[model samples]
Structure formats: structure tokens, C-alpha cells
Target: MGKLAQLSGPVGLLLTAALTGTVGFLPQPAAAQSLLQQEGTLAPMQDTYSFEGEADQTLTITLTSSEFDPVLSLLDPDGEEIARNDDYASVLDSTIIITLPETGSYTVVATSFSGEGGSYAVEVHPTTEYEQVFDRAVQLFNSEDYTDSVEAFTAAIALDDSQPSVYLGRANAYLGAAYLALGENFAGPQSLEPEVRDAIATDYEQAAALLKEQGKPDLAASLEEQAQIFRLVEPEPAPLRPAEPPEEPANSQS
Candidate 1:
């Protein structure tokens, strides 16, 4: 949501239902909407899916009856995890939310945490308005258009303020710009200036705020720790050069 938690009421309910697997009222509709593990639907001991996620995509996961160490993971074509969650509560299956960064095959793995048994539901689809903004932001970042890239990312976050990764990307961009500012001055062991230090701090702060909003306090704190460490040490001083004395006033006033 390039507008932040401003999603339509229905959309919010749909998302919550997908996340918690708590189907009620419109049982038929909910069952029809559930992509992964609808009741009675056979979920292969292992299940996988792929999608075109160039921009903003909403990938929903649902768990029916999970056991200890229940497993859920998403993989790119390169077999990299763009996002994943494997945690469980009281040996019950739990839905996890993850987003894709690029287009590729995504694998969703579900297994018992205790090496015994488990089941889950999953949904992978595009978040159009969200993806549009995300893609444009990525385009800007790759093109080295820092300001616009940041603006686009900001727009996306504003819509779904619950995403931690959005803030992470934006914060990284700000940190990159801050580091790039050193230029020729970038050489010193202590090369960073005070302004640069402050920029880094701000970047961490913004990112942490986003993570916190997403119900991830630990992650936010870790970023804060990172921001603090770099500020303590001063950058290396610039090298000094010898100076020559001024020449005698050109043969003084004739």
C-alpha cells in the first residue's frame, strides 16, 4: 500500500483471515479465497509455487494444524529466500506473511517442527498499487536516482505501513548516499564527517521505526546498535602536504 495501512476494510479482513486461518461467517467465500490449504484440500507433505513479482506483491501463508518446528520458506529461481518464517506457537500451525522482491519461482515448504507432522495454507498474488510503486522505486535505485527512489519507496510504505522491508530498503539507500558523500574525502580510516555520522543515525532510526511498527522490536534494536557503533570512532584525518615559502616580492618596486 503506497498509502500505508489505509487498505479497504474488506481487504484488511481478507488479509487477516489469510494470516490467521480463522475462517468464519462467509465460510464458502473464505474457503474459495484460501489458495493454499482449504479445509479437506490435500496439502502435499511439501508444496511450492512461483509468481511474477516485479513490484509489490502480497504473498499470504496459512497454517491449518502445525506441529513443533513447523517449516515454511520461500525461494527465488536462484533458490534464495526473498522472505520466510518458520516459527510456531504451542505446536499449532501459524500463517506467515512474506513478499517477493523479484519475479521467479517461489517454494513454500511446510514440515512438522518436531519432525512429526504439520499443515498450512499459502497464497501468492500481486499487490498492484503497491508493486507499481515498488518497481518504480527499484528502477530509480538501480538507475542511481537516490531521491526519487526514496520517494517511491516512501510512497509504498505509506500504503502498507506494516512492512519492515520497505523501511529497510529506504534506510539502506539513505546510508548509501551518506557514505557516498565522502568523495575524495572518502579515503581516511576516519574519513567520515560529523554530517555523515548524523545521516547514518537518522537512517537507522527510520528503519528501526518501521520494524517496530511491524511487530519486530528486536530487529529494530539491532539496527539501533549498528548506528551507534559507527559514530564513536572518528574518520582518519586527511594527509598533509608541504608548503613552499612565498617568493621575494618580484624585485620590489624597481
Candidate 2:
């Protein structure tokens, strides 16, 4: 199993979905299609819209109103608040980018920031291109193309750095590359360049930090231990050469 597959179940789903390139384009029943381009007036109060969303799917929800400052809130299937934003896009408008954690009913509340409602438009769309890149990264890593895997993981990170699993994948790719540089047994510390060593250490450290921030301290600890195994070992200094005898004043001696 690849390093990504070793992550917690929730995180494992993310990779599984990505590996299948099924984020934005997952097949769904006609009745469960995502909500799109809905507009109405909020009659001086909150207006809520409920819709079905798929797991590991990225959704872009945009709210625009001219009369009042718009506020948007997202709720999961259990009514747990996912995120809320006000004026994230422009004046009197709110935009939310959400990565759904599961496939179920979700609620979106659109209201005025000051509770003074007015005409508002809501648009929901999918953003899944990055997931494809993430999938490619996994494939490269599994294929043992460590250098290319690093690049692919980097591309995925550039698209979405919020995913802690991607950081773990990148860290492992860096470690793999470091081992490749050190030869078959990865024991040639003297031959390992400082930059290569630092790259490995830095990636693993980043992964650990991200994992900790994402509430996976145990996983972070495990990664930190792995990182220590590849810690840079400075090359021994060369023995000092014997000092050459001072040249006699040839002209004076002659």
C-alpha cells in the first residue's frame, strides 16, 4: 500500500476518490444532481436551500445581492456548520468554496449581513481538476518515480494546500528521492548532498506540522520518526594537509 493508503479512513477516501478522478464528475442519479443557478428574493429574513452533495467534491457557491451585504453559511447533513462567509467575493456578495466530506443533504443559508434581506442569486458548481492532479501524483509515487512524484505532488499542493494527506504524500516522495540519491541501501550519508538531505527533512517536517494542525498528532509523530531516520549526516572533514616548509630565499641562498 502507498503512503496515502496508510492514512486515516477519512483521508484515505480523499485519495481513493482522487485516484479514480471522480471528484467533480462522479455519476449521480438525475434526482440528485447538484443545485445550480438558483435565484430568489430573501423576504426580509433568512433563506435556506438544501441540496445533495457528493463526498470529496469541491463546490463553489456564489451569492450576489445589490441591496444588502450577503452572508452565506454551509451546513452538513447533520446540521453541523461547515463554513460561513460574508463579502468574500465583493461588496454585498459572498462566495464559498467547499470540499464536501460526504455525500448527503447539505444546507446553505443566504441572508443579509445585517439581517436586512433582499434579492439574491446563488450558483453552485464543481471544481475538481486538482483532484485529477492529485490522482496522478499518487500513481507516480506508487510507481517509484520519486522525482516526478515530487513534482506532481507539488502541483497538487499548489492547487489545494489545505489537504493534509497531500503533504504526507509529498513528504514520502521527498524521502524516496533522498533514498534514491543515497544509493540502494540509502546508507551513503557522506554522499548525500546537504540540499537533498534538507529537502527530505523539510518535506517530512511540513507533513508532520500539517498533520498536527489537522488533528492527527499520532500520524504526525509517526512521520517525524520516519524523518529522523533520514536525518542529514554531515560529511567528515578532510584530514589537515601537512604545512609545506617555507621556501628559502632562493636568491639569497645562491
Candidate 3:
């Protein structure tokens, strides 16, 4: 018998219940997409969702299942597997992002890695203006124009709050601007302007939380450490001035 058969009856029942709980927490398509959400129980072992695609257009497909490890695969019009992903950002759920090679109908398959399927939800969204703005923000960051980069990233976030990666980029911009404003001695928080340092720490904290939620635990931990460093920076002590040379006896002579 397989491992499933070795499990105690109660343990097996608990496993089944855990999978059942995931069905209620599946995410629907974002309102920004204005598309109808697609949801269904896996047909025994697999389910396929079909949608039209356009050349050069970016597409995002997400699959979530409560009972099994979801596997997502994309197939082109000719039924060739274009790309596939098992987990998105280390999360149990699966997400696939791609730029269509040609205009045609594409197939997205939702299935389990172990062939144990259950309730699942799938959503497809096309590239929007938010993507364009995000690209621009990235360009500004690369150009080292940290101030403008922060503004551009903020704009992108306003456009799509659902995207957690944007928070990471914005946090970087904030850190960059803080250091640039210092011009020198940016290593320690003591050398930084109080307001600037505070902003940097705040952004880092926000990024850490968002990254954790996005299933990037390692990155989140790193950012949290950086934030703590700034928060713990002690004010530098004032440099002591050399005592003035003893005044000449001219005062007594006068």
C-alpha cells in the first residue's frame, strides 16, 4: 500500500479536512481586470481552461487548490507546452506569467502534481496600463534617479495595489533616495537625516510584510533586518572642540 494507506484513520481524515478548507479562500480575478472569475472542482485529476491570446501581450494565469499541490501549464495554439510552474514564489499555489508568441487560443491546465485533485480556482488577466507604468518605474531606478523612481513606483502601486512586487521596488527607491540625500557617510543611520532614515525604515518594513505575504520569506527576512538596523541607529556623539589657546597677558598689560 502507498503512504496514504499507512496513515492512521484519524490522520487521514484530518488531511482531507485541511484540503477542504482551502476551497473557501481562493482568490477571484482582480476588479481591475473586469473579467469574470472562473472556479470549479478538478475533474477527477485535471481541468483545462481556454482563453484567447494576442501576440506581444502579457498574460497572468493563477491556479489555486485546497486539497492538492497545484501544477499549472500553458500550451500554445498548436498544443505545445510553452511554460509551466509548480509553485509561485514558493507558495503552494501556482501562477504563470507569459508573453504570447502569437495570436490564438491558449490552454491553461489546472492539475495536481500527485494526481490528487480537488476544488480549484483559476484566473486570467491581460496586461494593463499598470504594467507599462511599472516598466517605466524600473527604468528610472536603473537610471539612478532615485527621487523620480520613487514617484514612478508609487504611481504604479496606486494603479495596482494587488501586486506585491511593486512594494519591493518602491522600498528600494526609498532606500536609494535616503542615501543619496545624505551625499556622504550614508553607512550609518546617525549620518542620515532623521526624517530620511525614518522613511527608509518605514518602507523597508512595508516591503518585508508584503514579501512575506507574497511567499518570499527569505527576502522578507532580509528586508526586516535592514529595517531594524536603521531603527536601532544611535545618534552620533558631538565632536569635542580643542580648548582655545590660553589668552595672552595683553589684558593685564592694558
Candidate 4:
């Protein structure tokens, strides 16, 4: 069974109730509110919500369900898709953090990843500066803009160094930047600059140490394994030699 199917908690109970038709009528779309939490059942149709946001304000939207993987989308006042997410971190829940581009009513779409029906909860609220920066860094990493992602993750760390995810994010960004520098015809680790390679290793070590301190030894061990990649040394390739001319045919051929 999938992880979502294996969920055992309040969410699982809610899903069971939904599947058994025990849940009440679906709630109406939420009105514009500074902080809102709405519960509803997705019966193959997406639930839409509205929220008022100011330009430059950071908004955090989260969708959680146990019956199916959740998908969240943010649409601007003009109905343009501003941001979307299928999963937050490695979980089935979805989250989208974005800074409002203009002051207007925004729409939030709550749906399942595979159109499966289940009970779900949606939350919309303003987030802190640190979350804003950290989320931006994650978006940059997803887009493969590693250099900028590193800068954004560093800024997030500056805002709050308590988050282990930020450190891990910066480590991945550093590693990505190193690989990007090597390009398609990469010659392995030897082709990366010492400083660049060292940065990747250092960030991973830092993240692992932080994870260990947070009692996440398993995740820390994983990070340690990832860090070892930068320490690998690829053996030098053997030089190419010119092909020798073919030997003359034997006399028997004549």
C-alpha cells in the first residue's frame, strides 16, 4: 500500500468517515480571511477558496489529506497560476509559500494528485520573513538556478539558523552549482574547483550535525553519505593511442 493509504491518525479517521458517507455536507468556499482553516471532502471536484492579500505580503497555503496525495495551487486575481505544489518536503501533504505580486483577491485550489476523493483540510495564513526566504530558495533549487538558490538559502540561514532544512537546502544548492560548473562533459570531481567542492562538503556536514543535534540521526546519516560524494576522487583517464595499421594479408590469400 502507498504511504497515504497507510496513514493512521486523525486524518485516517477523517478519510474513513468520508469514504463511508458519514461526513456532513461540504462547506462553502471560504471567504477572504487573514487566517482560515476549512475542511471539506473532495469527490473528484476541486475545492476553491478566496483570500485577500496585499502586495509584498507572504502567504503560506497548506493542504493535507490521508486518503490521497494533495495538490495545491495559487491563482492570482487575473486567474493566472502563480504557484503550485504536489508535496511538501517528502510527505503527501502540499504547501505553497509565495509573496503576493499585487493586492487583490487570490484563489486557492484544493485537489487530489490523482483525482481520488477524501476528506482534507486547507489552511491559508501569512508567514514570517524566514519562511518566505527559505521557500524562495527551495523554488530556485527546483528551477535548477543553483547559484541564486545558494544565495537565497544563505539569506534564509541569516534570518534563522535554527532550521535544518535550510542547511540541507544550501548543501544541495552548492552541490548543484558544482555540477553545473562542470557542464555536460564533466570529468568528475577532479574537474570541480577545490573551493566549490569544499563548500558542498561543508554545508552537508553542517546540515548533518544540525540534524544529529535535533535527534534525527537517520537523516543525519543520510546527509553524511551524501557529503562523501564530494570527497570521491575519480582516477585519471588513460591517454588515447593512435590505431596501428592493419597487418598485410597472409601469402595464402594470393
lDDT of every model, 2 decimals: 0.48, 0.62, 0.64, 0.68
Among residues 3 or more apart in sequence or in different chains, the pairs in candidate 2 whose N, CA or C atoms overlap within 3 Å are: none
Off by over 4 Å in 3: 1-36, 66-68, 113-116, 131-155, 161-165, 168-200, 204-254
Report, for all candidates in order, the number of backbone clashes: 18, 0, 0, 0
Error of 4 at 242 (Å): 50
TM-score of 1: 0.42
Q: Model 1, range 70-181, lDDT digits (tens) per residue?
A: 4556667687765555442212444444565666545555555445543334443333455456556655766767777778878977765544445555655554465566
Q: Candidate 2: minimum summed lDDT over ten consecutive residues — where?
A: 1-10
Clashing pairs in 4: none
Task: Write one digit per residue (lDDT tens) for candidate 2, span 76-155.
Answer: 99999988877431124566677899999888888887778677666555645565566577668768898898899899
TM-score winner between candidates 1 and 2: 1
Per-residue lDDT of candidate 3, residues 94-197 (tens digit): 76667889998788888888888688766667545665566577668768897898898789778867555566567667767777876776776667676766
- Alpha-carbon shift of residue 48 in model 2 (angstroms): 33
Candidate 3 vs. true structure, TM-score: 0.48
lDDT of 2 at 102: 98
